[model samples]
Target: MPDAKPAPAQALSAPQKALLKLGLTRDIDLALHLPLRYEDETRLVRLSDARDGQTVQVEGTVTHQEITLRPRRQLLVTLDDGSDTCTLRFFSFYPSHQKALAVGARVRVRGEVRGGFMGRTMMHPAFHAAGGELPDALTPVYPTSAQLPQAYLRKVVASGLARADLSETIPPELLGSLQRVVHGTWTLRDALRYLHHPGPDVSLDALEDRSHPAWQRLKAEELLAQQLSQLTAKRERDALRAPVLRTAPGGLHEQLLAVLPFALTGAQRRVGEEIARDLARPVPMHRLLQGDVGSGKTVVAALAAAIAIDS
Candidate 1:
């Protein structure tokens, strides 16, 4: 039978190319790219009730729109709800923005409200045509580059989350033990979903500080992965072979130890013997000698070097 040819690689879209630049080629990678912060767009507030310096979402009909070139070319739209009115200012905007905020168009806008002689104003606020059902959860703002729009990234992230395998990686027994310690029972999938779009009622402070149960679950998994990687590296190192480094009895190692003016501490003597034993093995030795300042580590190194030279 003839050998089969490999499948051709498909060309990537611009957004997909941007995602690759962010090292998010795998479904798991995209699933793990969590939001940097959240924006509250779950409810609409009356313009009269909205306070200065507060980030809020307001829905109103555009009463007027104009392009003024006095300070710089800018589009200004006046929005009026039944209670009050505010100005939506945009230094940079497109035809789509003009159409969305055209006179008599009902739109929903979100940004920090500012009060001055100009009355309540929102600079470069995000807006769209109103009349859709409000989201039940807070909107997530992710870390992204210029090429990826939030809408496109949100769709792709949702797709990735749905397709990625999120089965528990930790052993059931170990996971249970950690869960008890942290007083958390969130599963991996549950954690990711909640973190991506937490309910509006969830504590924002807890999420921001990473003290929420979902955050704890993710942290535990990350720590476990690091420890497992270290263990795997150690096991692989143990399997490798190396030249047996041995010195004859009462050779340079012993001679050096006997000639030292200061006697070795009980702790030093114990460690020195252990290093000597490791050097006599056929496998490579990986040992770290640690001590406080002035703990006689210099003499230990001298002894080890003597053994090596003699061998």
Candidate 2:
């Protein structure tokens, strides 16, 4: 069966939909929803650099469209952006996009450059089809998995983009002060809006505008959540009363250290503190140790074994 997304228990609110569409997740696992990396596609390169078949993204006008008489059933598109020109060939494409590639129209093409033909570079490439005209913007190439169709995934992002009333989880006073401190910064909402709808109006420069605070906010939230969880767990563990182990601390330790061939290292001192703490607790020591040969570990092991036997 296709991995059917479990039906939403209730109609998802707008914020929830955006999270789902981004593939942040279908379930509410906060940690997993964090973005892996921020992909910046702000710079548009020239065609001359593409001569040696470089993988690049550039805006070019369609000079020619020859759908027939080609043996491999590929699109022969002569593209130029006033500065330079290159040939884009798409081998086996959905015929549906044929009408969109009218001659003399401007489009943005992203793909790899192939070998030169008659001194001009060729780009036998896989590209996103531009509609109407090239969008003036930096496009976000989301982390995609093989299971999702690219077209369908784009549509899913569009549908989930409808903004619902959502809270800016950060304190309003802090957010406002930061915006005022940094003049001309995109508000948190604006960045998320463009992130979902990266089309003609949103420019590449705008995406990378240092003033955009979305990334900082998201990163801070994730870090704080993780730290809070760890602290809470530690507090819970500390609250449990531990049974005090009856052993002459320096007496046992001094004898063990003397038996070792080499003096104890700094790491051994710190680790000894930890293991000693765990052993003193009434609970069974479930310490998973990274032991090494001849690390004075034998002494520590003997002492722990003696604890169980003597108790």
What are the TM-scores, per candidate, against the unseen true structure?
A: 0.84, 0.56
What lDDT score goes with residue 214 in model 1?
91
Error of 1 at 124 (Å): 1.5
Write one digit per residue (lDDT tens) for candidate 2, span 13-45. 665565565555532232222222233244567
Clashes of each: 0, 2
Q: How far is candidate 1 from the true structure (C-alpha RMSD, Å)?
A: 3.8
> Candidate 1 lDDT, tens digit per residue, 4-27?
998989988888889989998888
Show the colliding residue pairs in model 1: none
Top TM-score: which candidate number?
Answer: 1
For candidate 2, what is the TM-score? 0.56
